[model samples]
Target: MAAAATVVGLGGGAEKQHAECLPTSCSKHHSPKIRFPFRLRGHHPKNCGYPGFDLSCTPHSEYPVLELPFSVNVLVKNIDYTSQTIYISDPHGCFPRQLPNLNLSASPFQLLSNYDYYSDLSFINCSQTQDQIWIYRYRYQIACLSDESHQVYAIDSMSLPDISCTKMYNMSLPSEIFGYSYGPITFDHLRLNWSKPECGKCEARGKNCRFKNNNSSSTSKSQLLFNGSTECFDKPSMGAVLGPTFLLVVVIAIYHVYRSNKMKKADQVKIDKFLEDYKALKPARYSYADIKKITNQFQDKVGQGGYGIVYKGKLSNDVHVAVKILNNVKGNGDEFINEVQTMGRIHHINVVRLVGYCADGFRRALLYEFLLNNSLEKFISTDKEKNSLGWEKLHDIALGIAKGIEYLHLGCDQRILHFDIKPHNVLLDNKFTPKISDFGLAKLCSKEQSAVSMTTARGTVGYIAPEVFSRNFGNVSYKSDVYSFGMLLLDMVGGRQNTVAQNTSECYFPEWIYKRLDQGEDLGIQIEVDGDAKIIRKLTIVGLWCIQWYPVDRPSMKVVVQMLEGDGDTLTVPHSPFASTNPMPTRGTTGGRTFNSELEVISESE
Candidate 1:
């Protein structure tokens, strides 16, 4: 399995420092090599490893302590980078002492449980007379139990002595220490496995792996080095070396050229085959000439955004459509097809419908149902448009957006997380019904999984949840969309962009709204009637609830829909989201407050 490349959040200087460190290093006392996904605390910077793999080295101790998930620390005995497994030992040398409290429920590591490699030891308590009699019944001595208890304990449950004992219990442990005991206590070495940062393949390819920063960007990618040589000694016949002979060199050079061309064509063929399969699966595929005919040679431009430009077009049936011609696509038309397959499978009143797509050669475009009202951005820009919407219409739009998001999360066979959920992505139809659009950054995972691993940050800066940027806030999950939805809700209420800098003393809208709510003030905004005021209050309270600092604190979209539909007066205000006058939490630090229970404390660099 290829390990996922994690784009960690770190400063340029710190990231560069870790990148410059040796690819593989060893502890001063031990020879176990440590590399990416397992960095030594003082030797390598925190960004060198995945979250929760920080290794702390002590001057006197022979083994380094690995900080596992849930903050449990264990001594590392050896690590097999090929198998992605680690042999660990208890620091106290008595594993049974801590077995009662052993918990890896939420950690990324799992204890080895293969029955062929482990056996069970049953701990039992019995009277002196019972112990003496059982020692005779079973040829194996039961005296290898706890010395303090002086009770006969069965080493293996399958071969019990057939004698009765009180309070008998068993635990499965690694069989490596089956015959080894230290004065009636067994050894405590165990094995654990992790599937992050699959570097074994890189090593097998005769390359070194490390986290490399491109320019001075805040994100980093896992890079492999070939060193201008192919030393694949593991494979037969390929291990033979080439000597300096004119004829032999020519043959080898030709082979290398053939191999390079073969690999490049292989990659292109894979992408082509994938696109071909998608075309066969869906009827939405359109030819380039057909797109030109439908779009009338790109005549009328309707709207434009960062992803692409939208043009008004008419299909053969006389139905109007909006065609988006992608601009500056980064990779192999994956994003284009992603949008096609994602929108094609979805069917909801509040979700935009995909009519067809054009993936002919290099030209790519997506055809969607045309909406007369443009986007929610235009309606919320001025007071005239705001009055036209009224509080009732705006409330309905809010609820509609929530329902669309809920559908994306729960209604689909696979849970789709729309990373970007700003106002611009929400379009309004002729009836003012809002539908979610622009799924270029969306991710799909099994409905059973609460979180998905992301290689890079996907959403806009202002609306992105803290966890998306840093794992310290929490794991990136569906709750991230709720945070963006919260920001959009606040933007709708204030009739201005939440990220914009204000000229007045107030820096952000959330802080100002929180202050008003805290003081039991009437919001002091212009309102036509008591009904409008009540609706505004409900939206504000729900917005605050959605923007809670921690993902766990934010309500899910399902709950958000319920809150918007429920009575305003009965709703309870959430805890202070903008707790301090500062509108946002400090980016680089943990804020000096203990949220250990709320989030996993992986590393200080996050």
Candidate 2:
């Protein structure tokens, strides 16, 4: 910008300050780390504190208290300067009144859908029905864009009119709530400063004073240009001939850029040396040209998913592959590094292998040894024409997927729970061998730990068990993945997308399966006796046992494998499974209507 300035708004009105909000060396407890909107009280009579920030030390409490302008009574606890969030205990069970009342219309901070930064806090009203509602205030996380250095600032969520509080408050805290005030807000523009020799006549003189240039001038850094003219009466074109001088400046600027880039590359080389541990995965560095070549110049589009385009490609020597180049703005973390760090160490015959990856200055890519088949869902759902997967193939696919998930839970040194475990993530190799892919959303836990705390739920809807969705059942553990696997089995048996009928319609899958088994409806699913269909049916039953709503009821994959490979003749029917809030009708005495059309289709297609 040609000209910029900082405007400070006081509670009464606006004012200006040259120096930033840094504290001066006026006191022993003075903090220089404070910036903007935060001012040293009593340091300057001009009300130095920045707007929207109210900092105070009261004689009533042992520590200093910081208050938001809107929540006069609410005291902020534990400010993580790095993470840019503040923790505050809730004053009540429910807040009819919003502190800052986060106006989506106002702040730089925005609420995310299916996600939130300020999770509610719950204080039980045990006396009356034990009505437990989440308390209104908790820690508000500020997610700043690091590349642009986004930071969580207090004012980012506060409203301008709502930012009015008493400047002082008495803290009967951890007890009585108190009121506080917000200072003024003045930091809207950039302030430019230059030294002017005071007694500053030198600046006032037309011969030297550069305050000489008006603010309307296009450029601020004006200078005097000496002309070769012998007469002062000549047109004032002396400044225009400074072209050669400016040419010299341009040459110097180019030389500086070249040197700086060279130094940056050298620094990057040292950084690469420090990252040697990542070398074993042998992540490939692909040029944009290589990316084009591998994907046949992206001639064939694999499919479009949440992350980005999935393209089928090959390495230099014709090694077929699938490449998922993350979108420039993909929210999922770097898939290349995420996959490499998670799946790199573990090698299972049933799990997909990582061929290589690419991470350069501008371009980030991952290269995987491609699979022959797209995914199990494609063959299963494309239509009767593509229903080539019979009971045997489906059974084999189910068992293979189970083993892969089982390996993730038990085979590796760390027990990993593949959060997103559905047919979409399961790929088949050339010989119909199922290889589990996409460990990017996987979570790691230990043997002793039965559950890991998850702040937010991850994984696709419907496939996730009720226990995993809400903690009413219990904590999250590897069993969460087991629950998801159970849903997959139900889908395999039904031969249609599981989520659609369950979530949007009256069809509850597990309950439907449980009802048929109870009445002994031949499992209604036709797998041959002592053959692939029988094996798959047994696996389906075992899957029902695994996703029994309660974590304890679900069997581990180790037991599941045994059940799948177990003899079909002696297999016993498991009890009825748990039903969701909107329970589905049981099919104990008769067949389910939803499965009627799909069942005949699966049988005929097979």
Candidate 3:
């Protein structure tokens, strides 16, 4: 009986240890589960995980962080025991900055071999004067590393280019690093795998890998037992010991499943209720089968955005259309409801026409008339494309866009605020007429409402209004749309997005344009004719007027349309939009001639 008691005590102690080493996570949702060969350092016993696989929770964020050799720390995104792979990323959001000192040789993890090929890359920092020369020779310029006095570039060739540049560092990186020609180079996550203590087979069989005899010294030997001096054992089981506890878990699981089904049904009912009221709008509704037939199994993808992918399709009447298949998992049907409610009531020449919709089951899609020309983004991206559409045509396109925005604010029964207004959202027809599309982030309010409430900042970064990001700037209203349109016009004039400049010195393009105009200098852009120069000046001055820092100082779409329609002679450059001084009056004057003196003061409303 004494011997039996000793055995029972040992079993109880083992179970307690097992409970302590069970799977843990830094966050309930964001962080991955830490288990087996990979264990949380401070949360679990050192013996629970394999050597060189220890991770810890971040001090503030509580995110799982993996510390590699040389004190290089990366965020732990995921761990797959079955595949023996771990995904890690730079905690500071710049992997290239860490690559120079990243010494994976001292660590057990290695880059994924079968997935990607790697090459040695040398980072070179050169003087700013050599930028034009280097940019002409090498295409891979590292924007993050480049600064005011110097520029950084990555070269994959054997010898560095014959330029006056210093080699910053050399490291072996994936081949994809060389593929990016523009924008910042980034990796979503770096995949690594370990082969020291192979526990994949044990995991496949639903068993746990542990040191044989619970002795850490035996883990070094490869020929000791079932798995390289380690042993596979059944996971600790409480089902046999605690029947009532198991029953309670089962009941809780069933209740959770019931609750999930009830939630899904509730969502479905809400959608049905909206659709029943929306039927009166006269927009045709199609089933999922009809959607598939129209899209021909989504074969020809025309475009894709944050909301969904667009495919070219044909209706029963043989009319060509662009079908946007929205992401089903996006935002509990708010975007779909917004589009249906707003676009269904809207009818304007500048706005894209909504032909039909599909809300069959979980799948949702919106149909619109197919425009042969893609988006305004493609046209304004390069100077060659901008030249193809002469200054006069570009001016007309800007006017059309402003008119469209004006109609949305005044023409519709309820004011529609297009939160996202960038070149990508503006589609062009065969005649090159600009029509605003993508109402996914749109909001509707009464025409009398001057401002709107926003839980989060919406719209593309470069074109987003300052007020939309923070209320301290000003209240968000139709003026926010004016801000975006102003940025768009500036893009048309500059032949590129204003946010993306060649160097750090030229980072704020608007401020640069403002300074040049203030100094009585001609905008240093290619000018073919006097008419072209006048149009450029007009667009620039109007864009500056629209992008004032405060919403109260910005002109309404009504006033903006007037500015775009007027010839370039009378318009005067507005004050510096980025001025640190007190807010300037909504109306300004040059030579006692008021600039946009007709500007209306819109009261704050939500």
lDDT of model 1 at residue 215?
36
How well does model 3 score by local distance difference test? Answer: 0.72
Q: Tens digits of per-residue lDDT for model 1 on 186-234?
A: 4455788876556667566755444433232544432222111111112
The runs of at least 3 residues in candidate 1 whose Cα sits more than 4 Å from the true structure, single-residue gaps closed, are 1-283, 316-318, 330-339, 497-504, 579-606
Q: Highest TM-score, which number?
A: 3
Error of 3 at 174 (Å): 66
lDDT of each: 0.65, 0.49, 0.72
Candidate 2 lDDT (Cα, 0 to 1): 0.49
- TM-score winner between 1 and 3, please give it: 3
Q: lDDT score of model 1?
A: 0.65
Per residue, candidate 3 scores C-alpha lDDT tens digits across 1-606 of 000000011111134435444566776566777776776754566666765677665434445767664446788788887788888787777677777546665467887745468867788888877737545455466777778998777776575667778888776776664554544466555788888688888889987776666544545332332233566778655554344334433564576567556767676565444433322223456678878888899889988877789999887343678999988455666656556756776767898988778876578989888998989989988989998888889999999999999999887656778888889989999899999998877777766545687889999888999888888787788888999999999999986645545455555778778777889997888887669989998999999988888877777788788878877787888888885533544555433544443223333222
RMSD of each: 21.9, 25.8, 23.6
Sorted on TM-score, highest at the top, how do the candidates line up? 3, 1, 2
RMSD, model 1, all Cα superposed? 21.9
Alpha-carbon deviation at 586 in model 1, angstroms: 18
lDDT of 2 by residue, 150-195 (tens): 2112222222122222111111111111112222211111111112
Alpha carbon deviation, residue 567, candidate 2 (Å):
1.8
